[model samples]
Target: MIWTEINGKRGSIEIVSAIYIWIMKLPEAITHVTIYSDTCSGQNRNQYIAAFLLHLVHTHKTIKVIEQKYLESGNSFMEVDSMHSAIEKEKRFTEAYSIIDWKRIMQRARSNRHNKNVTPYNVTEFLYQDMIDVKALALMIIKNKTIAEDGETVHWFENKMSMI
Candidate 1:
């Protein structure tokens, strides 16, 4: 949902913003949200993401739960991994100096003969108005009440990134 800003850091802050934008665009019928990602503290499994998820659960009327599940290391060969491999294979031959170039490379990766039938990724550039920061709000939440300690439940926990 967000990319291209000069200072853009694809950490929890930016990720949470992108996710917020995506979730806002979800259909009305969608309530439960389930996210499956590798147990990486930098991306999916982080306190900022957890805080943003908890914020969504409380603020969004249609959202009931935003579940975060970390896949086990050796057993997590998801389809997305194949896509990443393809993208990396494609990138090895070229040089990308900007986010747009990377986006284009990713778009072209799935268009090869073998995976021509694969759906193209929708990599929209971020608009000026789309830049958002949930950090302060997250901090406010943490100050008010600590994040949930139970990571196994439907709710997003505030226990630390390692636990997530």
Candidate 2:
């Protein structure tokens, strides 16, 4: 588990940056990564994140396939929600006077739950890129499908640096 300052808009860039760091930290033996995310356009389901998914496959030779799955809009139960609930519960019982304090509380909560691996990150540490070119290429390659063709449901798939 990785904890970072909850500042800035939770947009595609932030989401992709977290994903990049997470994937880089994964063991090299793991090739296929499947991510489950709520279908939020401002965050995960967008051209920019899709471009980074392409970038991941391009940069990480160990990663062959990246699948981004979305649950129906009304479906409530999700792993991310569970993580949030855990953190919120911990926060209620712990006094966080500073960011470090909050970090400590989060780490303790994870440790208490047998989640030993935790990394603390600052917003500045997230690697950012101007994805204009990649987005253009992806758009050119994917001419048939519209971003909203499926309405509220989307199954985003990336392989061999190609987004489809």
Candidate 3:
């Protein structure tokens, strides 16, 4: 697992950057990944994020597949939220006025050592800005698209791509 603080509010750029950093640090043995993110259109649900996921599959031959999922807007009580709560609980007792402060708070959030590791993210290190226009590329390269019968969900897939 990987973690980090964003320079600003949680937006597409920040989310993409975080995911980019996390994937770059993943163990080479892992071949697949399923990312469950909140249904926030500005963040995970937009075309930009889809493009970022596609970029990952294109670049990393080891990762044969990557899936992105969104839970019902009001029904997100997954492991990620639990981890957020743990960090939030810790934040309540600390004075976090800078990026470093947040990192320290996250690092000290779990002292038990049994929880998944949390490493502070440096937003500057991952330059995802260059790929901001990936949404256009993704739209062009992804030709096979399927929509559920109900029309509530759509799926995109190929030899190394899948998203919903």
- Measured against the true structure, the TM-scores of the candidates, in listed sequence, are 0.75, 0.65, 0.65
lDDT by residue for model 2 (2-36), tens: 33445434566567657766888899899989887
Highest lDDT against the true fold, candidate = 1
Candidate 3 lDDT over residue span 1-164, tens digit each: 22234333457766776677677789999898988876677777765677678777887868878888677667557876766787788899899876667777766676545355644422343333422444465577554345534664563222122353
Q: Rank the candidates by TM-score, best first.
A: 1, 3, 2
Residue 127 of model 1 has an lDDT of: 56
| TM accuracy, model 1 | 0.75
Query: Per-residue alpha-carbon lDDT of model 1 for 10-85, expressed as tens digits?
Result: 7776777678878888998998888776766677765567678887888898988877767777876878788789
Model 3 residue runs over 4 Å out of place are 1-9, 113-164
Count clashes in each candidate, considering only residues at least 3 apart in sequence or on different chains: 0, 0, 1
Backbone clashes, candidate 3: 1
Clashing pairs in 2: none
Candidate 3 or 1, higher lDDT: 1
* Candidate 3 local lDDT, residue 101: 76
CA RMSD per model (angstroms): 4.6, 6.5, 6.1
Q: Model 1: how large is the Cα RMSD against the reference?
A: 4.6
Ranking by lDDT: 1, 3, 2
